[model samples]
Target: MTTSAPPNPSGEDESPAAGTSTTAATSTTRRTTTVTSKVPTVTAAPTSPTTPPATQVTTSTSAAPATEIPDAPGPLSPAARLEEVGTATVDGDELVVVAPSDTARADARQGLAALEIWLNGGDPGSTWTTFAATDPTSDGWRWAAVNRRTGAVVYIR
Candidate 1:
């Protein structure tokens, strides 16, 4: 009886040829695989356009009536009074006149009068006098005098 081996699973011959070298044979198999994933879809809410409120305006056609304005009044000047206080005999002479303690306004008026005279080229020596006067409008007393020869008015601060 003769015995034989089963066929090779790789489909290659197990026996070698006489007087020839033999090499090993290799085989390869390829296979394809697939993968899957699931995801959810999203939806957004819809919006409508809005409208603005209406407005009303009024217009005038006829012109307005004219009005008249009155003229403004002029400035008021203070009234001045003069009275002789004393006299000087010659140039460089001093004439002192003291104002009554109670009559500052009178003193101021006399001083102003002397100043006016000096300003008008009157001899300073003749106009020289010491006196204090107050503004008719205010209570503050001011000292003033005239130069003996030059007629320059001097005010004491």
Candidate 2:
């Protein structure tokens, strides 16, 4: 007697036993999509020329008469011929003074020392070995040299 295999319940094709030949079926599907866009249009109306508003001028009789203003003063005179002889650094800034003679240089050094002493909250009167100008408007370093024999004094800044 001969027997055969049972049918597949999943509905899929099954291969023949051993070297037997078999055939399969294939299907294909295709689809296409399209997109559309719309742009807006703008229009402007014609413009006409416009006139400015009228202005009114009034005069006053109570104003004061104009006076001539004095001209500004000219630049200061340049310091007299001098050469750099000594320098002092204060608050990270170097202060320099020029002199024409060794005595003036010594005076400049004394002035710088006095300035440093004053900056440190000390009395600088004793440090001054020569006459120092007493100009009220002057700031920074000021030095002067006095002639011991003739009593002549020269000031340099």
Candidate 3:
């Protein structure tokens, strides 16, 4: 979901369709941030928005190389970009992921990786469909998604 013309490779046209691969993008109707669908020849630029904040980055270190990926594909697929997560809570005034109690335990990026791995193997059972979580106070809550088939709660904020 996007809300306006997304910022692309700094100064390039913000056209949703103008995006190449690598750079992160948001929908024009909602604030859903994600990456383009393909890997670009050029290394993608850093800095894409998330539910936590617009400037937050999950870096390993100051020298760690940065990567830019596109949005996750349809349901049951490994999320290339975190935005592929379907929203959990829908009643809030602002859009954000509402983490569940287990959010802290299974929330490292590795969990996201695991979910991706599971998805990559082809969502085997029908136990998990998809779901979102709710935080008590964080404005709009954080964006959280759940596996309906396995009862797995993966926090993608």
Candidate 4:
């Protein structure tokens, strides 16, 4: 009796070769396993390009040229501009005051009180004196707080 095995290139199966184990020697080569990967593709949806019925978009722009604007006047401007720009800016909120001399301080307090009276819709105080006349010691140096737009004195002697 005679036996023979088939040739296997993979060498996975240890089956006897056709002429090797059965006859004299079988032939086979060692092989390593290899893996390959494949990926699927993505597709977009279909949209219809239908036309509009009759009207809608009127793309007209009415932009004017840029104009330069003027600046507004400051707060404490007595006539056109106050002589007291850098001196001090006074508002209605400020109340008590101190003067260089007691006489000036007294006159200022009286003036402020008279202003308050005027604001309250009443007659202003009567016996108020102006340092321009009474205090010649200063020799024409008189201090005052006047209204900007109307040139009305707000405080001082």
- The number of the candidate with the highest TM-score is 2
**Candidate 1 TM-score, C-alpha based:** 0.18
TM-score of each: 0.18, 0.30, 0.18, 0.20
Winning model by lDDT: 2
Rank by lDDT (best first)? 2, 1, 3, 4
Model 1 ranges with Cα > 4 A deviation: 1-105, 124-127, 130-143, 146-157
Query: For candidate 2, lDDT tens digit of each residue in 44-101?
Result: 7778889766876778788675432212111212544555656655567676644444
Worst 10 residues of 4 by lDDT: 80-89
lDDT of 1: 0.40
Worst 10 residues of 2 by lDDT: 68-77
Q: For model 3, how does the per-residue alpha-carbon lDDT over 1-157 read when each residue is reduced to its tens digit?
A: 3234555544556455653455444433434446578765886689777666667776674665533221321232232233322332223332333223422333333335443434344442343333232442342223333444234444444
TM-score ranking, high to low: 2, 4, 3, 1
Minimum summed lDDT over a 10-residue window in model 3 is located at 68-77
Better of 1 and 4 by TM-score: 4
Better of 2 and 4 by TM-score: 2
| lDDT of the candidates, in the order given | 0.40, 0.44, 0.38, 0.38
